[model samples]
Target: MPRRVGRVFRPGSLADVKGRPTRNTVAGALLLLLFGSACAAHKGPTSNPRAERELASDLTRVFGAPVMSQGLWGVEVKSLDSGRVLFEHNARTLVMPASNMKILTLATAAETLGWNFCFTTTLETGAAVEGGVLKGDLIVRGTGDPTINSRNERAAAVFDEWASALKAAGITRIDGAIVGDDNAFDDQGLGAGWSWDYLQYGYAAPVGALEVNENVARLTVRPGATEGDPAVLELAPGSGLQAVNHAYTGAAKSAVTIDFERRVDQPILIVTGSLAIDAQPATRDVAVVNPTIYFAQSLKDALIARGIDVTGGAVDADDRGDLPAPDARRVLAQSQSPALREIATVLMKVSQNLYAETLLKAAGAAQGGLGTTEGGRVATRALLSSWGIPQSTYVQYDGSGLSRYDYVTADLIVTILARMFGDPRHKDAFVATLPVAGKDGTIASRMKKTRAEGNAIAKTGSIANVRSLSGYVHTRDGETLAFSILANSFTIPAATVNWIADLAVETLANFTRR
Candidate 1:
């Protein structure tokens, strides 16, 4: 008989995680105390149940007491072969997935648009330059390529390519304005239910058909040479942002608390707080107001550096689904983003919000000719519906799961994982994207010294009061299992909740069939 473990231990509080405490508070703590004592007495697997009996015991022990009171968890684990369900606890309950929602978004993208799909950005002109002068605007169009960043290219190298191509096409000077056209996708910049707090950061960068450097401006801040002096500020790929620094340099040993904020309903970048004299320079990446205009201006600057000056300034065309007709002139140069599989890998491994949103809009654009979130939501549901995943399992709200409104069941996540494994065409490409426990990506520090180390591939998610992890694991008995564990409405520390979830996965990895 397995010994009953009656102890309920809670580690840390949720007060440390920025923007996470709103979901957990004193009221939540009171609720936890009320029901935790009762939940602690519950049992699992009354009879002898093979490998899962121990797993149930472990989960039962963890899900009891004060920790469980703070948050509700939905967990499900199923065997790929033999069609056996290993464990289930509130598997059908809808919970916040956070960034783990990327699993479905990435999967849908890879399936709807083959893994090899590539987004293209092209350069065209309505009128060709004669004698190094063009009378009309130089139009640059993008088809939802998320690359064009410093990671892939350096120092506007790609834009320099565009400039060279323009010169090669017999254009030494652009006498007209440079126009940026992103009509391939709709004008919807932010996701549905996205709050302004999220829209100001790079992670919540506005999505567009054309994006450069992730549509953000990096603000580097360095303390002044002496105390009581203002800190120095600089913006990279600076286009439409204006930062007002109200920060001051403190003593060499003074406490450092550098901060940046955008006041209520204002587009201004307000910098505050303090920095030490000897402290290293820090960077804050903020989302730009307009990505299309930024792209246009960036190219304009690049052309100027390449000795091609424009008589007129950059033009955005205020693309509100009203784009000018394509020019009859031939294209001068083009830039192609990496294949969809590569982008998917980054999206899952790092849980990138910008890339996920871009892919979501791309899906809608592919299916409905409009890359709006609604269009993507319709197509995403249909794509999963075709795979037999019901609409009831999830409520589609936004890409990247940043919105608090996004909800999904653990059972649905496991089902999707199982189906993806069965697909021979995308099994390798899809699974490779997940973070390997104690080895790579988001879970690099998870499940260390346990059997699950380096053997589990999963997606991790975290928000205010939410934390989740879901993916595939191979048990000691050589059975492949798909699992999803989601938690919401918790008042405890997010790390402790994550530890409980990790223990559950480790138990699955160590399970024996015999």
Candidate 2:
């Protein structure tokens, strides 16, 4: 490592479920459908009485390990094929689910928006383009397109394409501002019950209709040439925020430690601490403030970089008045995001929080309502109700489980699994999104070479003292199983809880009726 700190900043920063037969709540009712209808219709992979007892014993030992003694655990495992509850402990208790919340968010979105739904972001203008000059403000209207981010592409690729399209259309200069119309989503950016400390990290990024780069900017810090010299700093998407470097290089081979801070009322990020001259460069991503403005400014910079003349500066539509109505605008450029299935894959595979939130708001907008978190919640609640899953089983404060206020029962999670697994409309697309054990996604390195390896596909969740793993696995006898394991208030390391959960899954993968 040549100590390269190539960050985007001059200074920047960085569920449950259970089963069966109760009609008042959908959790149990859905279980009956997965089980009862199957038994009445035909023979499925029935659970063996002796095998169930052995599984109970194995799971008890796995969860009873001393590492889990201090934590509160909730788990449920049921056969989607046979419709029998294989194992459950505290399955109905409400617990914080972390990113597992994305499951519910994506499932509802897939149902509401359909598999092929795509988000369209457009560049519109109310004035004419004459003699290579755009006479008025160029507005960018977004419909909560999460794929506009640079998770796997250049930060300015989308904007650069738009500028090229403009030049090809004989538009070389803009006479007015480049305004961002992020009105599709509300002004509330941060999720409910999120801690203030999380504001500086990229994962706690704000949500907006015009979000770019996932509302995050990376900060890179490198050691100076010699000891006691000021540390070098850089930021990506450098148009938005400013960085104040207070860090210094230390002696060669010394330890590297750095801290980033942004005061409550300040617009600048102050980087403090030191890095050894020979140490590798460090990088971190930090959330930006007022993401709508960030998106507008970034687009403005991209246009300028592409040899386009921008006589005016970037502006957020919320800060301006006298804008044209929707019908009065003419589109100059547009970007269509990948379909919902692809978007949902990113959401589940990496557990992208902004994606979950963006999709939720988009769902609300698609339902003929303003795209607000409350509206999203209403849409999701209605969807859950339609499935007969009782609203009392889960309390969703935000699409991502990043909010500590979000809670759900193991029973509810399994119900979601069973429903998605059994849904003819979304089964393949839905299950394909989960991370595979010992193969891909967040759990790529877990359970390698074990019976669970490549056999378990699940969503993993973690936040503070909470840890969760819920998904599906196939047993040795070829029985398909849906399961959820949640551990909260644990004193042990999160890896310990994950180990126990992985062990439990491995145990399930090893089960055989013979």
Candidate 3:
């Protein structure tokens, strides 16, 4: 038997109901059903289960091929809107993150130190001036700022300002040596875990409490005729650096090879090359073996040229207690830069190793410790933990991620991205620092033509055996998702690994939400 409410049939019509207005009741029931369905739809899709399975299949197929080598890899993708894990595989496995570790360092710095932080460099006198002849050393205090490099013209300007200040103080001569105060950091310029082979190269530029010109000298090489003749090695004029050239020449078309070795007994630069005279000039930027001494000497010379005579050679070490009192003086000059946020953008975008390392040290120094790798790690971890992120997952050795010892999981990185996306205070700064696919930074040539090509913004990591990509992507449906993919121990060349990673990202971009 069927019960019905209608206008025409008495048995099946609303009028068939004894003493009740069936039309009004039927209308109410219909409206209630529509409202419930609308509410369910408004909740949105929780997870794309089918899409997750397909993504897993794609990864297995790509890496399981006979030609592919075995490796530890992980991938995780989460929907930003629903906070659901759409896809995940071994997301807890820890592996070397390489340069990708810079993300953590930068994020911690931005949050803890604030983006407007700036470092200061100051000059102090050690003795009272009597008739323009000071009786003690001139102290240059370093605040452990790493931005003071040879490439920075502003640093040179700062040096000039110091000279002007001395002149204004009516001090024309010093009876003692110039002391470099580098006590802001530990004496270990290079970290303990860094490889010995890297020390001789510019890339291993030792971390210094007082860094000048990135603690390196530029040597321009011009090939000389005959194998025995010395190849012309020109140092930056007035750099006060002495070079011992052992470079030799060979026949044309032969490749040039350069090797440097740092002896435990004494640090020395050993140059060897077989470049031909007709070949292009080779230029090498070698790290300054002793940055503190280098800076002191250069400053001494500059001061001497300005009619301020230094009685002795420059010496390295702290002289805070020995400095004279500050006199009433107006600001002679000041150098300003874009806020810390903008500076961080360059650090992350270009993968600037020096900048990252320096910023970490600055944070440590701000937190009551001599700026060092260990100090920076402690400070960075504390910052991340304060943000409610679990610090147990990350192992940070150096800020640049140049060490093979640093390890971080993909899941943790994606977690960070998710937070930054939702955090109004840091959202813009963090996103702007990431490299854009097919446009800039490490991803300038990656993920071309896929939905992720122009829409994805990420940070890339690469080392001898590690390749990682992590960041955010805007989907076709206007949904922003966070993802991280880390591949390690691939037997193939880095180029091939990059190709596979790009493909994975493309698949994620094209996936349809169901």
Best by TM-score: 2
- TM-scores for all candidates: the values are 0.87, 0.89, 0.80
- lDDT tens digits, residue span 1-514, model 2: 0111111111211013444423223322322333334334543665479978988988888877876787899999998877888999999999999999998898879988998999889999999989999998989999888887776684567877898889988998999988999988888988999887767788988999988888888798999988999999998753356789999999998888888877667767888999999999998888888788888888887888888878877788988988998789988888988899988888988889999999888888888867988888988899899999999999999998999999999999999999998887888788768887766778888887676765678999989999999998877666789999999999887887887788888888888887
Candidate 2: where are CA atoms >4 Å away?
1-43, 154-157, 237-242
Badly placed stretches (over 4 Å) of model 3 are 1-48, 63-68, 128-136, 150-152, 160-176, 234-244, 301-311, 318-338
**Candidate 1 lDDT tens digits, 455-500:** 6779999888889999988765556778999989988888888888
Question: lDDT of each prediction vs. the true structure?
Answer: 0.77, 0.83, 0.69
Clashes within 3 Å, all models in order: 2, 24, 6
Q: What is the lDDT of candidate 3?
A: 0.69
Better of 1 and 2 by lDDT: 2
What shift in Å separates residue 94 of candidate 1 from its native position after superposition?
1.1
